[model samples]
Target: MAAENQTQVTEFLLLSFHGQPFLFILFLLIYLATLLENSAILALVSLDPHLHSPMYFFLSHLSCLDLCYSSVTVPKILANSLRPQATISYSGCLAQMFFLMWCAGTECALLALMAYDRYAAICQPLRYAHLMRRGLCVAAAASCWLWGMLDSALHTLLASRLSFCGAARLQHIFCDVPPLLRAACSDTRPSRLALHAASLFVGLSPFLTVLASYLRILLAVLRMPTATSRRKAFSTCAAHLVVVALYFVTANLNYNRSSSGAWPVVDTLVSALYCVLTPMLNPLIYSLRNQEVRGALRKVVGAQGTLRLHS
Candidate 1:
C-alpha cells in the first residue's frame, strides 16, 4: 500500500550528543530547573489573584508554553541519558516536530503581543485599560493559539508526504525541520521551502515587529517630562525586553543556519540557550522584576506556607 515515492520510516535514531558522558548530569540539572521553574510560574499565575493583570496573564501563558514545549523532548532525553541509545518512532518524531514548532511559533506571537501591551501601557498610559480590555487580550491570545495550530497543521501535512528510504538517524535531540529533511529520501524541496518560509514569517517578521514597537516606545519614553516616570516605564519593560532579546538572539542563531557551512556544536550551544536555559529563568526574571507578580507569588507561597504551618 505504500507508494513507491513514499517509504515508511518506522523509527529515527536521535543523535542528541555524541560521546559526551559528563554532559548528562549537567543536562539533568538544567532540565529539572526548567521543569520546576515553569511549574512554579504556572502555579503562581493560576492561583494568585493579585497577578490578574494583562502582563502576568501573558506571562502565565508563556510559562505554560515553555513547559509543554520542553516536555516534548526533555523527558525522553533524560530517559536516554539513563540508557545508551535515544530513539523515537517515526510518527512520534513527526508529532514532536509539530508540537515543538507550534509552541515556538506561538511563543513568538505571544512575545510580540506582550511587547505591544507594554507599549500601550507606557507610551499611552491613559488608554492602557481601555485598549487592553479583557476581551481584547483574550482575543489576542486566542489568535496566537490559532496561528500556532495552523502552522503546526501545515508542517505536519508536508512531513507526512516525505519518504524515508534507509537512513534513520536524526542529527538532533528532537525531530527538527533540518534533520528530518536531511533524513528523507524523496525530494524535500516543498517541505523545506514551506517550513523555512514559515520560519521567516513566524520568526523574522516578529523580530521586525518587536523592533518597531520598542523604537516607538523608546521615543515616547524620551518625551516624558519626569525622569522618574521614564525610569519607571523602562523598568516595567526591562524584564520583558531581556527575555525577548535573549530568546530572539538564540532562536535566530539556531533557525537561521546556512547549509553552506554548518556548525553543529555552535548551533547546539545556541539552541541550548533557548531550549533549556531561557525557559528555566524566564519566570524567575519576571517574578523578581514585577511587584505585582512578586505580591502574587508571596500570596501563593504565604497561603501554602500557612497550610504547612497549620498542618
Candidate 2:
C-alpha cells in the first residue's frame, strides 16, 4: 500500500525568495565575491614562493574546496530566485546534495588537520618541518577527500532510496539530508540513524580534534619564555580560530536542529550562513588577518600592475 502511494517526483520546488529581485541581486553579489576571494587565495598560494609551505598548501586546498562548495548551490539559488517558481530536477537536487556533503565533510576534517599542523608548528617548533613533512601532508589531505566522498556516497544513496509520495516541495533553499528525510514518505529511521551517526563522526569528532589541538597549543604558548614569542604564536592561530568558530557554529546550528519542526526562515538563514556566507568570509578572514597572505596579495597586485605598464 505504501509502495502504491509512493509517487515519482520528477522535480522539486525549492524554497526560495522567488520573484524578489533584491534577493537575487544580493545572492549574485555574494556568489561573485566568493569566487573572486577564493580565486585570489588559490592564485597567491600557487604563485608565491613564500606560500609554498605546508600551511599554505593546506590553505590552497581549502580555497579550492570553498570554490567548489559554493559553486554547488549558490548558482542554482541565484537562478531560481529570479523565477516565478523555483525548481530543481530530481537528479540535479541529488547531485547538489552530494557535492555539498562532500565539501562539508572534507572541510571538517581538513580544519582539524590544519589545527594539528598549527599545534605542531607552535609546540614543536624545532621539529615542525619533520612533523609536517610533505608526504604526510599529502596523505592526510588525500584521506580527508576520501572520507568526504565515502560519507557523501552513503548519504546520497540513502536519499535516493527515499520515496517522496507525490510531495516534491523542499522546506529549505537547498537539498540536504535533513530536509530530504523530512520530505520522505518512507520510514526514515535508517536514514535518521545514519544522519545521527554521521553527525557524531563527521561533524563532532573533527570539532573535538580541533578543540584538543588548540588547547594543547594554548598550554604550549603559555609556557613560552618570552612575551613576544607568546604573542607571535597567538597571532598565527587567531585567524584560523575565528574561521573554525564561524564554520562550526553555523554548521551545528544548521544541522543539529530537530528534524520534526518546521522553521523555514531560521533554516534558510542558518543554511545561508553555513554554505553561502562562510565561504566568502574565509578568504577575507585569512587575507585580512594573515600577514604572509597580505604580503603575497600585494606582490601579486604589484606584478600585475608592472605587467600592464610593460604592455
Candidate 3:
C-alpha cells in the first residue's frame, strides 16, 4: 500500500517567496555574493604559496565546501523567487537533499578537524608540524568528504523508500529530511530515527569534539605569558566558533523539531539563515577577521594591479 502511494508523487511543489519582490532580489544578490566570495578565497588560497600550510589547506577546503553547500540550494531558490510556483521532480528533490546532507556532514567533520588543527597550533606548538603533516591533513580531508557522502547516501536511501502522499506541496523551501518525512504516509519512525542518529554522528558528535578542543585551547591560551599571544590565539578561534554556533543551533533546531505541524513561514526563515546567510557570512568572517587571509588578498590584488600596468 505504501509503495503504491510512493509511486504517485511525481514531483514536489516547493514553497516560494516570490510574491515579495524585495526579498527575492535580496536573496538573488546574496546568492551571487556567496559564490564570488567563496570563489575568491579558494583562488587566493590555491595561487598563494604562503597559504600552503595545514591551516590554509583546511581553509581552502572550507571555502570549497561553503561554495558547494550554497550551490546545492541557492540556484533553486533564486529560480523559485522569480517564478509563480516552484516544483522539483521526485528524483531531483532526493538529489538535492543528498548533496545538501553531504555538504553538511562534511562541514561538521571539517570543523572538528580545524579545531584539532588549532589545538595543535596553540597547545602543542612544539609538535605542530609533526602533528598536522601534509599526509595527515590530506587523509583527514579525504575522510571528511568520503564519510559525508556515505552518510548522505544512507539518509537519501531511507528517504527514497518512504511513501509520500498525493499532496506534492512541501511546506519548506527544499526537500529536507524532516519535512519530507512528514509528507510520508508510511511509518516514519525508522527514517526519523536514522536522521537523528546521523545528526548525532555527523553533527552533535563533531560539535562535542570541537568544544573539547577549544576548551583545551583556552587552557593553553591562558597559560601564555603575554596578552598579545593570548589575544592572537583567541582571535584565531573566535570566527570559527561563531560559524559553528550559528550552523549547529539553527540546524539542530529545525531538524530535531517535531514534524507534526507544517509551519512554512518558520521553516523557510530558519532554512534561509543556515542555507543562505551562513555561506555568505563565512568568507567575510574569515577574510575580515583573519590577518593572514587579508594579507593574501592584498597580495593578489597588488599582483593583478602590477600585471595590468605591464600590459
Give TM-scores for every candidate, taking all chains together and pairing residue i with residue i.
0.90, 0.94, 0.96
Who is ahead in lDDT, 1 or 2?
2
How do the residues 1-105 of candidate 2 rate in per-residue lDDT, one tens digit apiece? 555544467899888898778878888899999999999899888898989999888888888999999999998888888788889988988999999999999
lDDT of the candidates, in the order given: 0.78, 0.86, 0.86
- Model 1 regions lying over 4 Å from their true place: 1-6, 18-21, 224-239
lDDT for position 212 in model 2: 93
Q: How accurate is candidate 2 locally (lDDT)?
A: 0.86
What tens-digit string does per-residue lDDT give for candidate 1 at 13-63?
A: 886653576777777787788888878777877887777889878888888
TM-score of candidate 1 on Cα atoms, chains taken together: 0.90
- Least accurate 10 contiguous residues by lDDT in model 1: 1-10
User: Model 3: per-residue lDDT, tens digit, 1-311?
Assistant: 88888888899988888788898788889988999999998898888898899988987898899899999998888788778888889999999999998988898899899889988998899999999999999999999999899999998999989887767677878778887887778888888888889778988999999999999998888898999998887876777788888988788877887753466788888888887889888888766567877898899899999999999
Residue 90 CA displacement from its true place in model 1, Å: 0.4
Candidate 3: which stretches are off by over 4 Å?
Answer: 259-262
